[model samples]
Target: MFTRTLLCVSLSAAAMPLMADTVWMKNGDRLTGTIRLLDGGKLLLETDYGGSIPLSWSKIATLQSDHELLVKENQITGERAKSLLASDEGKVTLANGDTPKTVELASIKQIMKPKPFVEDFLWKGNVDVAMDYKRAESDTDDYDVDLKTQARHGKWRHNATVDYNRELRNDVVSTDNWGTEYALDRFLDEQWFWQGRLEYKRDKIEDLARERTVGTGPGYQFWDNELGALSVAGLLNRTDYEYADGEKDNFYAISMRWDYNRYLVGKTFELFSTGEVGKPLASVADYSLDAEIGLRYKVTDWASLNMKASKDQVSGSDGDKDETRYTVGFGVGW
Candidate 1:
């Protein structure tokens, strides 16, 4: 009797259908696993036999999800629904139980897995650090570090960035600088947004001790595609400055910021440029400009090599000069 019972249980378990997801390749290969994320022209899959595998978007012929997903089409913003594979040749079924909407595989922009409401609001951060040294004649050392974090919930997004740099000469600290910026953006629609930001920094070499700025304005997303993106915003800002010589002043200014990014080598490499200009209402000649250009080469599924050059310029009562800085750092993102 015991033998019979064991056999019955084993048969039931074996007869149970698999709940795992599936992916079909253009070459007629079938992968059975859980679909993790589809981003940057690549699809991630977690399998029982092999570990996580990244399949190029061009190679994926069909996608079948075991759970609901938030999908974005080339024309539509965001929709939540179930999906199936192989229902058609070059389309995916919406599976809404009504008139199924067939979306062209090429028109699908992004796919996100569903998570708990609170988990969607959790922050994700990336950090990079680099150092340099010169040992002949005059000893000098330089350091650069940056940390950035962002979170998205519904139509609102929050971002924070912090960076610090220092130079040492003969074991003494010569240049010490650090800054942090916090920004909040609320999306009004597909291409427009309202933005606010606060920033603080200090420079010792420019006869400047500390600077604080607060700004907010409207912004626009000109184009966002698989290849590149561009965004520009204008802000009304109030800046306060304190120098090492015990002089302090504040001014109202107009500021403009722009950022551009392009993906090269099909997500393996990235090129980016960003800049900001500010002019004080008291005097137009007294202005500030900050700009940076950088490239990041993806090394793994989560890490990259980063290199950047930036120029900081200010001509005002407290300082008048330009500082150029270069850095090479290793960064990781999630």
Candidate 2:
């Protein structure tokens, strides 16, 4: 009985690799794992023993997958394959029911698991929190919470963001503000889209008690892939401002907005920036800018350490305003 059980255990261990995706390297190394995706010259493999490993695409001799995947070739459209079959060096075959198409590995631009038909949307987002405390002649405490999320389904995409900030000095509230924004994009083609957005901001301790904005414009997507994305938009905005002293003003403005992010070193670090600058057509304010630049270091697949600098300025409001802040925080991303 002991001999029979040992034989069964050994056979099971040997059969595990046969059930998973396998890659043959140019240096004659064999690896078995689940192929997560291939992008930005890196093929990501999820392994039981080594978590996720990124392999250089050029160094792969051949590969085969047991599951279906979407493969894009030469920056063109993508096709769904039932499986991948290893061919000669630098070649792979997409296996369908009865027709297997062989192609050069160098011609493949991207490979990703397809989302289920019932749930055809991709969702991603991040939440960040930062706090500051100082003990001196006067005690100070500061807190900030930022949240951003987006979902994409076919030609439609939705984005939402929320921010809250508070500061206290000597047990007295010094700064308290919160803001929220929502935007929707409808893609006309691969790179062009139209966007409509609404934003609202409120401050409890400033003369600018309330602000509202509605904007719509055309945007261009430069590129969006596993590595990073960049996009820009031009907008015509209608804005309303209400002051704590019972003063109100409305203006029409033309503005530009941009969002950019890039990942480096196998996605271990990310550098990002996003902001909007606008010139109000009316005299309520000459120009306004709100922007933030940040860096994130991935601590794990979902956790990160982040540092950010933000600036908010208005040239010709009731009182000229300029504020800058720096924060170190932790965040989670998906």
Candidate 3:
């Protein structure tokens, strides 16, 4: 009976699978996990005990991936090569069986799809809702909800966002605004992409009832890495606007858009800013500007607190056509 028990225990132990990835940290720490991906200089490592860890390349001294990965060599213009990865001392040794190619680890633009068909296509996004309620002699309320997502498949990428908000003071509605935006990108090279964008918005307080815009442009990604990204694009838009007074006008304009984002403190904090300026080719003075700046403080893996301020300015409108808003809220997302 003792021999049988020992034999069964040994068999079970031998059948268990081990983690396929190992990371050696620069400070002499070691970790074992399943590697989800390596993108933009960050590695997604899923561990049994710690859930998912976002480990930057800078923190990693060496790594070994048991499975093969598709690698993009620091430039989208280059073709992807499949290889088993071994990293040590700032170099990656690729195993393709013909000849061993050693490349700088920093020269790898991205790596993904270790299993061929599964991880290359995936979707990830976050949803945030913030609100405040106060009861005094009069009741006050404010709220905003935002949903954003990005998905990837091969060389194509899709992004979308939806926003809704409401504000009340002294039992009177002060502001109500909502909008939806969708964008698609087709990457032609590492730094250049062709994009199409569509936006629709309606604001009751600003008396801007309806807005529809369609634009196509060339975008340049100045930087995308572990720290963050900055992208700028110039687009020609056909815009149609309607006022709450039932007046409407349509025009064609050239617009410049800039988006900047950064992650700090081990991805626990975020700062972002985006702005757009439009100049009507027919009426240059009839230009407009819109901008927003926001900060996010992550409270946990799936929760965050956010503060945001935004400004909207429109030209040739009657009676103080500028609107500004400040809001605070918390959100939960995965």
Which of 1 and 3 is the better model by lDDT?
1
Question: By descending TM-score, how would the candidates be arranged?
Answer: 2, 1, 3
| Clash-forming residue pairs, model 3 | none
Can you write out model 3's per-residue Cα lDDT over 274-329, one digit (the tens) per residue?
77899877652377888888988878767889888988788764323577878888
User: lDDT for each of the candidates?
Assistant: 0.75, 0.87, 0.73
**How far does residue 234 in candidate 2 sit from its true spot (Å)?**
1.0
lDDT by residue (47-108, candidate 2, tens digit) is 99987788999999778887989899955689999998776778888998899999999999
Ranking by lDDT: 2, 1, 3
Candidate 2 has its poorest 10 consecutive residues by lDDT at 1-10
**Model 2 CA lDDT for position 309:** 95
Q: Could you tell me the lDDT of residue 50 within candidate 2?
A: 87
Give candidates' CA RMSD values in order: 7.1, 6.2, 7.3
Tell me how candidate 1 scores on lDDT: 0.75
- Every model's TM-score: 0.72, 0.77, 0.70
After superposing candidate 2 on the true structure, give the runs of residues whose Cα lies further than 4 Å from its correct spot: 1-20, 25-29, 36-43, 48-50, 55-62, 65-119
lDDT of 2 at 65: 86
